[model samples]
Target: MNTETSEIQGSCHCGTVRFQVRLSEGLMTARRCDCSYCRMRGAVVVTASLRDFDLISGEEALSLYQFNTHIAKHYFCSRCGIYTHHQRRSDPHQLGINASCLNGVSPFDFEEIPVNDGVNHPSDRVSRGGSEVVGVLRFVPSNR
Candidate 1:
């Protein structure tokens, strides 16, 4: 991603939902989670403060889903069913923007993304520690 551009535009698959965000740490913060939901959804995410995220359109087309502790709120487009972003359960003040939803970006764009151990969430730890990145997800494109 371009470090020079802090703010970027995003939308769902069907374009029913659109938004703008200022990434907290550019694309360097991109990561994946090993939690059940994340494993299935399979989206690489980057961080952004809640105040830095702006929902430009499709308020009615947005649908939210939450489970388990329900601290994190996952959002997707109701029209196209594309996961857009989510409120971080570890830090409610921050939102995790699906990197693929960002314009001109794709999950495969990152070669190696740290995979967090959501199964052993830091908040649930005895000392309430920080994120535990278990491993890395790598994407190597073959010659076509």
Candidate 2:
């Protein structure tokens, strides 16, 4: 919880979904998950307690998607199909903010991001926070 206390604004691709999040430590918890769905979507995520996230607007324009165990509640913009944030399956107390959706921030600013083994989550398995290390990812900013 040792972080610069700041409120950051963010929106979806179509600008329909808007939100404000209070960062506990800016991007200190930024990371990527190696789960089946996460590996394909390829979004950098940051942690925020449930009290930290606020939907500024576009609740009606939002849609939800859940798969497999269905513990993690993933949200997106119905119009823009942009991933916003999700209730972490591993830690239900935190919402995993999509780092790509944060304003004035780039995922590439970090040289390295740790990957979580979401494929074998603690909820689904007996081991809590297993020692299985997936891999680290390097964010390369796109020209466009």
Candidate 3:
């Protein structure tokens, strides 16, 4: 996370779904989950208000996948088949960006951040640090 305010760009693996996000320092929030799908995908979640994200291209080239609770609508590039961002089921007002999808941002940069387990849907367990663990669908401010 850059301390200075800067714009970060991201895209799917195939370069089809391109988007930009404006981030403040410490925007990469690490969320850990033991849930089957999240664990299997190894997702580190970071989020921004819907107003902060913009789809630059490949609208037609994108595909959406939803299942189970179906609250979160996962977006991926149809061409390369990469998960880009998702409309959060818990908070439809925000978009959860896969931190791995953003360019120039490394997961190592925010490794010190705490991880919240979404496994078994532990929606009520707060971490030792006192941050609220509302649900598996948590959002961190991009301009934190």
Strongest candidate by TM-score? 1
Give the TM-score of each candidate. Answer: 0.96, 0.87, 0.73
lDDT of 1 at 19: 97
CA error at residue 35 for candidate 2, angstroms: 0.5
Stretches > 4 Å off in candidate 1: none
lDDT of 2 by residue, 6-68 (tens): 688999988999999987677887888888898988898888988989999999999999998
Question: How far is 64's C-alpha from truth in model 1 (Å)?
Answer: 0.8
Every candidate's CA RMSD:
1.1, 3.3, 7.3
Q: Global lDDT of each model?
A: 0.92, 0.83, 0.69
Q: What would you estimate as the lDDT of candidate 2?
A: 0.83
Candidate 3 global lDDT = 0.69
Taking the tens digit of each residue's C-alpha lDDT, what string does model 1 give over 62-129?
A: 99999999999999999889999999999999999999999999888888999999999888996868
* Sliding window of 10 residues with minimal summed lDDT for model 3: 122-131
List the candidate 2 regions with Cα displacement exceeding 4 Å.
1-5, 130-132, 140-144
